[model samples]
Target: MPKHPIAVELEAINRDGETQVVRDCGLPVQGYSVYLRAVEASGLALATWIADYDTIGPAYQLAERLSIALAIPLTVLVPEPLMPVQSGPAATTGVITMAN
Candidate 1:
């Protein structure tokens, strides 16, 4: 069966986020990718991104690219939310909360 990218990617996100990593078959990959495909109520894919991995360089780059691709802003929140607020796109607008 040819697994849809959205389904495969969503499984990876749910697994990794809950377990903090994907573990199965004893030889699990060290890191996983969160491929987000946001679609509207009309079944149109609005945006997508491979987010929040150990190698943030790729994710970060993808965020930037996806922002342009989707015409929607991308944002990231630091772990230390209490830190002094520095003005930035991710810091100010486009609030996204992850459950993990």
Candidate 2:
């Protein structure tokens, strides 16, 4: 796998403990603030969410209600679905078997 340029820069800065430089360079793509801002902009009004499954319609209604009540732009925040972690020896291989 090819090393990404941004990764290389980050690694170098990390090695040197360049805290200031790291802050200046900004957060990595998957940063929490980025996700929060994106969700809020989309009209979801959560700073974060509880770790539980949710039904969408009620959440959207609440978001809309709150937005109107507070006269602020925001939306309901919901937890992302869990992504299964790949591990063990089988992880190295990409094939997935579907039981019939």
Candidate 3:
């Protein structure tokens, strides 16, 4: 599966003076990309960097839904969270690297 971009709020305040802390509530723009078929025939590529693997699965799931909901194709760059490796350190290495 693919990963979704995050929705982030860069500043503490907008022109309105109040800033929206969407850290948990939303994702950063770089975290996800929205591709409209009508706009681009090939569609947009999924993002490779993500906030965490924890949300990778959900991001892909959302992409699938968006594809159907918006009638456009969406791809998530990150793969779904995998089961813990029984090998301990060896398996954890990849997870840690990707997280970074």
lDDT of each: 0.38, 0.27, 0.30
Number of clashing pairs per prediction, in order: 0, 7, 13
Evaluated against the true structure, the overall lDDT of model 1 is: 0.38
Error in Å for residue 20 of model 1: 8.5
Candidate 1 lDDT tens digits, 11-67: 122323442323233333333354555556556654334455644345445544554
Which residue pairs in candidate 2 have backbone atoms (N, alpha carbon, C) closer than 3 angstroms, thus clashing? 43-74, 43-75, 44-74, 44-75, 44-76, 45-75, 45-76
Off by over 4 Å in 1: 1-37, 42-52, 78-100
Candidate 3, residues 30-55, lDDT tens digits: the string is 23222322322345543332222223
Please state the error at residue 77 of candidate 3 in Å. 1.9
Per-model TM-score versus the true fold: 0.35, 0.25, 0.27
| Model 1 lDDT, residue 88, Cα | 60
- Give the per-residue Cα lDDT of candidate 1 at 63: 49
Where does candidate 2 have its weakest 10-residue lDDT segment? 3-12
Model 2 misplaced stretches (Cα beyond 4 Å): 1-53, 75-100
